[model samples]
Target: MTFPRVQPEPVYRNPEAVARAVGGKARGNRVTVHAPGHKKGSPEISILVDPSAPRGLLVNCFSGEDPVAMKDWVLAKCGEPEFTPGDRSERPEPRAHLKLVRRAEPPKPFNDQYLVARGYHRSATYDYTSTDGEVLFEVLRYEHPTDTKTFVQRQPDGHEGWLNGRGDAVPYRLHELAANTADPVFVVEGEKDADRLASLGYLATTVPNGSWPEDLSVLSGRTVYVLADNDATGDKKAVVAIDRLSGIATAYRIDLPGLPPKGDVSDWLDAGHSQDELEELCLSAVPIAANDNAPPGKPLSIFEWTVDRFVGEAPAVEYLVDGVIPLGIPGMVSAAGDTGKSFALLELHRRVAFGSGIYAPPIFGGRVVSEGVSVMITSEDDANEVHRRIAALDEKGDRFSSAGKRMIVVPLPSAGGARAFWKEDRRLGLIETDDFKRICDQLHSIEGLRLVTFDPLASFAHVALNEDPTAGQFVCSSLARLATETGATILTAHHMRKSKAPIETLADAREAIRGSTALVDGLRLAYAMWPADEARAKRTCKSLGIHYQPNRIVLGGVVKANGAARRIMSTYARNESGLLIDKTSGLGTSAPAQDDLRTALVIAIEAAANAGAPFTKTGASGLFEMRERLPEELRRIAKGRLDALAAEALERGEIVRSAAKGEKTAKWLDVPGGLFAIGLGNFTTGAPR
Candidate 1:
């Protein structure tokens, strides 16, 4: 049978002296004979093994053939070439062993004594235990000698692991947490912070792995406040914990500000934040679920809608302009650019606030319920410009100064300050936000507020006005609710499309309003203003003998009157004083003579006949053309008065009209003795026939 190679035991001469050698230093002629298959390069054995006298040590110790066989065995073990017995001085240095020594086992029930004995004099121990008071793990945090920390846990068979040998460890202070189920649990990243918070009288706990627990079901149905350490890892752990505990508990993250990197709750306490302040901080933490802040409600049955529930509630329809503009409903005024829409609305606001009647024909009987508070919220005009407009309107002698605090003019924010009223994350528009609510609340505090106006609605609306009908409706609905809740009439100014052609009738003006149709459909009332026919305005100015400004003529018409009259048109002219006045009642000066009206009608009819189309008495085209030929003063008179002028011209035979062939066709027209009698052939004479 082949024998297995065995390392011989090393012989030590003067063993006591060799054993007493420290760090390769020895005395008393000591020698060591290493066995075959034994490592010769070990530093521990090198002190006794001198290479110069290897034969004396081995041969002197082992006689006969054993020394030679041992030498060959040692050479084979060292992986050196075979050498004669006398060639020891030329032998190579042997290789050293590479195997590591076995580590010592740590003591059980590690305490302050074990820590002190291991050079961890200044250290803290935190024990993580089961509900039955059995210790599962302990974390030792060393502060002195060196800054280091370690985790240790005992196993079921009395063996120890760095952390827990079992699966995952439970949270620190599991027993205390079970004892106080009603109190809010404060979760932190580590056991030290947990213990620090617990000593401060807070119910604190942490995971044993020094990270967020994979499963946070232990905190189910409890309010949890996670104090994140001021570091990336701590934030990550807190976020994970929050996400895991979302539906299971009302979890909130508390991040202490002004902390150093890697700072923790202990550091916050060290910085002198008291328990009361910490509690306040915890209270201020935002809940992980945003909907948690919403008001609670129970489901209601559809059958709850009964007649008695609404029969006793008959809300009377109130109005700012009687039938035209109903109170408790949103209204809009749309006008083309440079039409003085803002000035017109401001004038209305003045009228409402000072209880002054409009100089023009009354749209809503030109009366208010009473002199009451009126608010004008405008984004187009600044405070100074608004004040200037108000001051200019006050020139009408209504004495708005006497109204005192009733008139509230608010200039909205401009670019940079302006934010979207409808954000993607919120269901409420900016008008319903807390900022606007405070505004409304303050205005509602004023007794008898009759009207609130938003000049240029597009400025306040942040959504795509033309694309999003729903957002438009939402804004209108919000305004309507504001009106209904506060009993104030709300009017918002809007813009109309610029028409290449002049707006002659109310229908044409209504069609010119800009934006989605919802703007008009959602409101109870809407009004439109556009530039009147330039020819008609100029003719009216000439008849009245007043200098005409083309832009000064504005035609105001009711577009949408849900609870009121269908068509109410008014002619407004801005005078040299910059105040819009009612020109439909005729100019401020005297009226033109009857003969001049007839002469003007004959001239227009003869001119129409000369062209392909003849003049018709009732046709709009014929009337518009005839009015264009008339003097400015006559054009200012209402349409009824102008029609009467045409009838008188026909009765006196100054002009004659034929029957119309169709609805749009104008009746044939002729002079008493044909066109020649009207001096068309003798144009140089410049005289009537």
Candidate 2:
């Protein structure tokens, strides 16, 4: 209760203070709030009691323009959400005082990309973040207010978070429990049912997962039977809603066709249904919705060039795809060091420009095609340096491909007189509209320019990526436009940011990029590379084995690599040798490609291990057990030809074991001995902090 003093004194009044004081506001009439001892200096709120209610109705006239507000709103009372409007000062009869404050700013952007799109299917979960200056904290709580009363918090283990909301939070597992619940299990959207389902002797819970949870430990105890909402309908929404959770459990949607239209299971229970009716509904689970968007046909190769047509290897489909050549999305490569950066670009330039067949092969020392490819070197490297690299490529041209793949490299002039707000400043801003068009004409003049490569993204952008927003937008837009307009495949490289750990993430290209997010956000296909384990990487060229030189893989490299030592054991087939020769001098003691399994494995075991950390008798014995236990295909004779190659790797000192310090055992990764998992330790110095 707030009583305005007959003679009021201005002490302190702001939005927050007013909100605390105002219990209610009534317009037009000055209802004399009768409070005792109304002094000018000290004011009190008079909470009108509802005698029976433990707390009284907080009384205060919140400020507002009765004329400005709607009639209904002018009469409404306002109060805080979590209010325990403390006791009224006993000195005199008090009146609750109230006032208003201006509105706050709009909410921040959504954190997850998944949430940004419109469909949530089963449920839409929100992620909350609490930051205290330099430190950032994240929390995922799916306490659906709709039915939280029935849901109770439980003690949790392992995950980083305050399970009961009582302790300071660590990392939270808000989605669902990853327990061993036998085969199939039933899952719901809210916490209450998930918890209750487990007790009802059914395996279930509010699946906390927004995306498909890959781990199946949760289904250890039961086979899954995903029970979807009884209300959702339609071809697209229903299927996606179910498809998103296809693997967790075999889907079985609850069929509520006989109940009130759109009535949920909770509604049925609320309506006082007998036990039998509820049981019947649960048993009548329907099949999950069907999927209609099947995958597109696989492309023969991820990358393509013009010759792929006559060459017989390219997809050779009659119609060409505009944005991402359907399955032919070529990988884009980048490097931090300038040498690696330019070399990578030059290699691609040589490959597509001349079609000398860089990765394409036998077709050329590289491969020769009918016409040359066009390359737009927008990167800011010195034009002379680029010329020199091309000269080197040609000198080694004999070492690369026999194909006369010529590239017309056009360097965009670094400066311009006055730039077209949206154009590349190749002419130092000197070009008029006609001049820019002529530049395009000259490029078009090149007979059948098929691929373009951009080096050092920094040089291409006229403005600084961060500070100059307008320039960044213009440059990124230009690259995208050129790719579309020219019809020539465009491949450009951007510098990868410095990371404390190795970057194995497939789409990590987009995140570490320095400039506007637009650069990667606009690209069709992307690939990322970085040095792997530093401990082992330093040993790459140590001569521990015969073939331990720093070689490239998928145009990416590990900062450090862990490999076993091996030699060039004999090969069985002839074609494989054709690829191994140094295309430059075209000189090498080439060997057969295919050798049977036993011969290959025998060679590897004898050679790959290092004297630095050679496999002891104990280690060798374990490997023998492992080899014996391998599936039928991994055995000596029945093993496919590929296994024979792996066996040969063991024979030749090709792979060297970069024995990790203090490691008694190491897990096998896609690469020999990369990090065991995403969050595991690396480097001898320390683990992830």
**What's the TM-score of every candidate structure?**
0.45, 0.30
Residue 330's lDDT within candidate 2 is: 27
* Candidate with maximal TM-score: 1
Query: TM-score of predicted model 2?
Result: 0.30
* Ten-residue stretch with the least lDDT total in model 2: 565-574
Q: Model 2 segments beyond 4 Å from truth? A: 1-332, 357-371, 396-405, 411-438, 463-477, 507-510, 542-689
Give the deviation of candidate 2 from the true structure as CA RMSD: 25.8
Tens digits of lDDT, candidate 2, 246-295? 44344554544444654444554556665476456656644442221223
lDDT of 1 by residue, 9-93 (tens): 4433442343343212222233334443443322223233433334223323232336556555444443445547544253333
Question: In lDDT terms, how accurate is model 1?
Answer: 0.63
Most accurate candidate by lDDT: 1
Task: Give the distance in Å from residue 153's predicted Cα in candidate 2 to where it truly belongs.
Answer: 86
